[model samples]
Target chain A: MKKSLEGRVAIVTGGGGGIGGEVSKWLAKEGAAVVVNDVGSDLSGGGFSSTPADGIVSEIIGSGGDAVANYDSVAQPDGAKRIVNAAMSMFGRLDIVCHAAGIVRDRMVFNMLEEEWDDVINVHLYGALNIVAEAVPIMKSQSYGRIILFSSVSALGNLGQCNYSAAKGGQIGIVQGLADELKVDNITINAVFPGADTRMTEGMSSTARAYIEQWGVSAESSDAQGIRSSVRNAPKVAYLCTEAAANITGQVIGVFGPPMTVYSQRVLMRKLYKSNAWQFDDLDFAIGSSLNRNIPESRLGGKYEQR
Target chain B: MGDRFRGKVALVTGEDHDLIKEISTLFASEGAAIVANCSHSEWVERMVSEINAVDGVAKVGHFDLTSMADAESLLNFTVDSFGKVDVFVSGIEIRDGGSVLDSVPEKWDEIIRPVMKNVFATTKYVSAHMRTQNSGQIVNIIRDKKIHHDISVTNSIITEAIIGFTRTTALDMEKYGVGCNAVISDHARNAALVSAYICSNLVTPGISSIFRVDEQEVSLYSVPAIERGIYSSDIFSVDELNYLVPKYLFDGEELS
Candidate 1:
């Protein structure tokens, strides 16, 4: 009997540690040849080391799995190209790309410097673009591919993660935006909002911690539940990259706990119409009377304290 | 009847499209001072003159869609001219067309940088100013009508990203009394009206939402919810999901 991914090849960006590292091991355990790409940047995305990627590759190889280490930064287009090339040269074909590389620059929107915003956006959002841009052609040629962008619950919005949110949020858009187009070639693109305890999240502020608590496991770990562990996120992510999950595309899945969740694609919730241009007073009255039902409570700003 | 924007100042930026022109004019007609920003100086100046001719305060500000410095200056130009900015309307047309597999990395940059990247810069600056005033509305008009099969996947991705960015900005700014929303429309008048309505006092500033405008109808995009879930103590493998998902999620119907 053969493993599920016996002949498949996968590129796991940021596979050096945490969820990405765990995911790399999982894919390898299933018999895929894995390219473990990591810059091994610190929590704030500064400094670099190759040890993370090398360590993960060593572990996989030692466990009777085929894997190679690639120290390429996904934030750059050329780096993404080299990362893909490394996979092809070592494994001959590329079939799966799990982009889990990320960094955080948490700060109040007002206090956030341009560099802070740029750094986070570059690593997370631009990095997603680079990797997918390189891998899509091979997948298209083969008529099969599975791409998973490791977005976060924070993409919806965190009190001090406007930059990170915007980047992760952009990734979700990429998944949805590319879904129909990719579906034509039997390729699938989806987002995974993983709630796990990782080094990237260890330094969260008190307000951010509280925000995560209120939002529950859908956003991050429900620490008390003890079920939404970091490694638990791997199965769902690995599953999405499999042939069994072929029909699922453009979906945003949250893997944090005992029960994995599929989020609804955004749609029209309520509408107000006017034959003529809507006046301020009239539009207000219409929304106030009808559209206000089930309006999402403000999650940030001063509303954060209301909890 | 048109005093909905009385005493307000608006910064309208985007293409030389009729939608951008109409939004500038409509806001001016509703008694708001207008800063019409576009790369085409002659076209925006013409619109500015048209608004000024109608006894509405209007000014022309230049912006290069891909330039962050230009974004900052555009906001500054609005404030310097009008004392303070009350509303910002961004209307950008998506560029390039091709499947992601066919396009190169530079193509992705070309498609994303001008629209989404610039929007991020403008939003960051405009919201910062809005936070101080404790009042403002932002309406991003992404012309999704032309986004079809031939359009690049990068284009679609950026479109979705802008929408997501809109939601995040709305959330981040709501506490400061700033409303951020995206408008998807091909119709000039409808998009203009929706932008005006969202900027109006009636819609609370803290509500970050997406609105689609077609003809006379304005519909709001809903926040995504959990469609369904199955509980378990441990994570399920592919085989287990193959069994349980069909039984529970699809009522025994196979996923096609």
Candidate 2:
């Protein structure tokens, strides 16, 4: 409604349903020519039909907005390039990119399979890379662009989600690296570690579900339909992708029900002793002493950490 | 350029020759009247003259950061001249010696007074002025790395103090629609003292090299070093700051 993004072109991967779909609709409503790239995969990253993408595109068009549909897997290089190309061909230029495509394979490291790791990694991390690799050149040429990558709280080392953590953590690292590198090019890159319910959470165990529910969301209500009907939390993931966030780069920000918080993952807390030779005993003593005196987590705890 | 900040006024304080010059010049070029202060009058005069030659409006104010009265005067003069204080950039860093046991009390006060206290006093006065107008942006430039020999204890304390001050001011001022944020940078090329420290004491056979002259050296510190140097222009360009400052001050709303 603000129209701050008028005349812009955006590509939202995993746009067939859930948060991605909402983000796509929001972008289109703001006057962006949106390309809803959905492969119609389930929570575990299996394929379905392209109907979901088609459905969202229809909804946008029916609401008197501009949108197109692309049924491509963000897991591959060619698929990623195709999504960017779709935006360029349909809308003529790309201004914003929201890489929200991901899958959840919850497993403890002891029982995690190689394919499980690869599947989540391929969808979230590589999918992000695929699109970014293709989009950066176009962004550089235009001298203006916004890239928003998705990280999750699980990246902070959640139980039974080693693979998910690895992928999400990698995404944060990529966001920071890209943000620092591309700021000079006028392309701002940032990561959002959102705490919202979606199709991804419905698959978690009941214990995990109960823990997340305390944060004010039900697992069942995160379905694609539930999100469309506004049954989820406030300040949806779409808010972070808007043009008003242009100045925030290389930051890991969290949003939950009207409370927006900026986190400091990269912090220099204590100055430990490091001499010409770092013996094991000396290193241990230095670390212990530093930890005892100053809690690194407590420095910026109130704003970021769970109360 | 456009008169985006035509009616706006800004103040920057520091002795880092390159940073002070670049920030003042950029603000002036964007139609914001600049009041730049340094310890030395010659540096201030030089910057003012250069800005004038480029058709930008700027005036030099010579003041030491150690004085609270001078800091208050800088804010008062800008508001008195331009009718409002819209932006503030703190670029002062005074590094002296201090460690846990060997640090002298005098040195501690000297180092903390200029870098951290100056910012606190300046923010106190400016936020008071901006609370009336209900809009302002404060960008505090901070060194991400601590340069201390035996002075590691005090260095960490001072660095953390600045960040705490910035965050506290941000939250307190948010109600009045004022925003304060810190820009963290690794050792900058223009910081002559930092450069000397890295070159002299840190250069050794086994010690991991801490500083790199080339832009690519940023990769060594973190994964994201796309280029070298820590100047405002290299880290965040004028256009980017223009976009960010307004966004932070207005909280994602469109600024007129």
Candidate 3:
């Protein structure tokens, strides 16, 4: 593959470990000046350090690639500006922003405290906004940029993740909204739902993890090509932060274990209408005879316990 | 409709054919004391009279749900009569009919406000009531087919926004023995009947989805032509509505 992003200045907000770390390394190997950012957050959004980010920066530099470590948090506006500044000050330009910064605070929605919701949304959704806001003006001035936001299948109203789901769902709106606003400026923004295991995901969705553990399976059960196959998609994720992907914008791509698919957003399935505004009683009866009475049995909601 | 809801109280909106004659009547037949609420329409008195004739308990009311005062009044009426609203089936209004760019502020406000604010106000007041008993279901009825005929841009936005709203509210109310979900009416009629029962019978751990009432389910009941769905496309005609209403609702019922 070509070093398509060569000479491009890029920032990977959670570049310290797992998905973000690999993405940062790949971007650097492809010849971009990488700013590997991480606040070294423990899984629950507490406890931070600069070591993880520094370590990734070291790996990139050691491999003869240009890189630097940024320890600022992306969850705050000022922290986001500082992260962007790290790229311009170090590499003299800003081009790619791979927003991989996130935190996990899983609980049944009812069990979640206010702070839990705030912390998770702050990192995943608001953090995405802060960095994009700091970068968009510069990207517009230079007339070129690529933005990639994180989303997941859980965004379809998964249990025990109301805060995470809502924030991720909101990201879809931002990707669509920003893609339109920046289309004329040659800046492309898209959301990627990566289906891979990382440090942060190690203990989440415990029921599934317990099942996998029972089978003695982990993220790298069958490593090959001198790197974990599950993480091989890091290169594909890096590709979105390159000029080669300029035409792909305002879309949600599902990057599963191997085969990737583009998702259709908010499609209309069917319709029942009237020439005049609907009256309350007439609508109820019409809905029963039409919309409700028509659909097949198994395709409806609440098939299994929603919680 | 089943006797499972015989002693329950159901508050349904829309006074026309589907919301009243079908969904609401179906509920009353099964024993739910009905609160057939509607905006002042010429057809409401007749709808209520038919319900009373069948020995089904029902009370009719006129309130523009967009206004908080009106929504509260409607809720108050239900409380005064039935002692509590076990199920609140909300019917949305759709007015804007133009391209997104052509839609002015008033048009957007007019079309979107009533649909969403009704949800906010009704759920707010009803949720307070359900909290006292620690049990209830909020079924938001959305117009799935309205824009299918005329590229109703504003309606599309409002509907999609409500889905987002429903998911968040589901999260908020699940703790209080209250479950929130939505049903997509292929049209405005029979809108509340099926969904109201679906909402009233929503078991613990409700399925959160947009149930599109298909042609097959419509054929099971003897609804008029206007009460059935027609379209620019038959994309989901083959797909079942179980993703919203669940399979139990259609058990032993014809899907053809």
Candidate 4:
């Protein structure tokens, strides 16, 4: 097979963490010169250091792949702009933008703090907006690009992930809305609901980890097997980055462990189409008699019957 | 009579099901050694007795799929007895079924944890062994969506994970000549039979999918066994298997 991305230049945000780090390496291996961007902040989005990005860059270079390190927070316009600028200045061209950087602040909806919510929003959603916004102009000028945003399964509404879910879900909307706008420009954008056993999961308590770990699969094993391990989610990201995936865009792909699921845009199911306006009694009768038989209950609504 | 899986060794989980037992019996009847894995000794004894009567090679492995310890024990017992596991059949059945309402935090863990452990532990050890040989096939059985009602969120999650793992494992093991895939069906017999073909030399992993086809008997197989030089089937077929087997294994003899 051809080196699908040979001679391309790519930028991967949060290139220091688990999924992002692997993606950086995989893209570089595909012959793309990478700008490994990581503002090493702890889970709550605190301290920033250059080491995360720097370490990945060095590994790439050591492995005979070209890479440059960018230590910029995606939360700030200046930082986002510089990161994009570095991609062009250092590599002389840019083709892929992978945004996998973010932090988590978990709490119940009622008990969640304003700042906590704001902090997560800034990093996950706004940060994605800032970084991708900056990359858009550069990609447009080139007429060829791939942008992969990091969404989460929480977008489907996890119990204590309102802030994270909101931000990630918005990322999906961004992918959907911008997809058509960029299609004429020959650019493809998509979202990934990634599951990797990376350090980012340090937030989970030991008891929870122990419970989950019984069946938990790490990205490292996936990478090592050269298969779709949770972390091997990187390879799919790399495949999307390549020209081989020219027709795929405005889509959502999920990676947890063994499976890579292509999620459909929501469609109406078991609808009761009406010829004209109906009385409340007619609607109620239809709903009970034909429309809602054994329909799935809402996850958020927390309703369950024997079915 | 044809020995389709001669000299092969198959390790099958889910000993409680009669379908899986018959599947094991078919593999053994075709001359491959069988490892019948179960959680209870009584089921194992019942399974082994029938195999013994047929002059078929078989062994009883009683271990929990949930524990990492037990997973290791299962792998070790299989390897220690059979020398290696060429095909892994994840036919596990957990009857703790319910809907999303049962998808509570505590309940979610209760349901997903054991299945998760079963998948990972098996993959970790068995894939490691297969990687050394650079050749193997893994088949997982999931409930088919055609009859997918009354399903719990817990089983739904488990099925999704198995699928992801299977696809990725297929990708991971491709270079090493190892293939992994899964089948989705309500009837264990159909699933177990399709998996038997997959584990046998007749079927190899070229296309990965959650197989949802009917598993009719050989007499009921309506599709022509051979079509043109392509060899196709509306349902699974041993003839279609020829296309997927490793090229070197054929020694340049074209099946067509």
Taking all chains together, each candidate's TM-score versus the true structure is: 0.90, 0.52, 0.63, 0.51
Per TM-score, what order, best first?
Answer: 1, 3, 2, 4
For candidate 3, write residues A1-307 as lDDT tens digits: 4467777999999888878887898888878999999999897889999999999999999999999999999988789999999999989889999998888887654345556766876788668767887888888889999998877645545456666766676566567645656778999988876645666566556323322232233443563322323354466566667675666687676543433345555443345655555444444566555554534321232222111
Q: What share of the true interface contacts does each candidate keep?
A: 0.54, 0.00, 0.04, 0.00
Please give the distance, in angstroms, between residue A212's alpha carbon in candidate 1 and its true position after superposition. 6.0
The residue-by-residue lDDT of candidate 4 on A1-307, one tens digit each, is 5466788999999987688998898888878999999989887889989888989999999999999999898877688889999988888778999999888887643245556656876677667767777787788899998999988655543445545655675576557656666778888988876766566664543322221222333323335543333345666677778775666677676544443445554323344444444323443365456543444432111122221
TM-score of chain A of 4: 0.87
Clashes of each: 1, 2, 58, 9
Cα lDDT of model 1 by residue, B28-138, tens digit: 889999988788888888878888888999998877746668878888888988889889898867765566556666776677666766777787788889999998888
Off by over 4 Å in 2: A203-244, A274-276, A292-306, B1-256
Q: C-alpha displacement of A156 in model 3, angstroms?
A: 0.3
TM-score of 3: 0.63
The weakest ten consecutive residues by lDDT in model 2 chain A span A297-306
Residue-level error in angstroms, candidate 3, position A183: 1.0
- The best candidate by DockQ is 1
lDDT of 2 by residue, A179-259 (tens): 645777778777765545566765554433432343344455644433223212213344445555556676665533223
TM-score (chain B only), all candidates? 0.91, 0.68, 0.76, 0.76
Candidate whose TM-score is highest = 1
Which sequence of candidate numbers ranks them by lDDT, best first? Answer: 1, 3, 4, 2
Docking class of 4: incorrect
Write candidate 1's Cα lDDT for A6-106 as tens digits: 78999999999988998999889878899999998898899999999999999999999999999989999899999999999998999999999988888
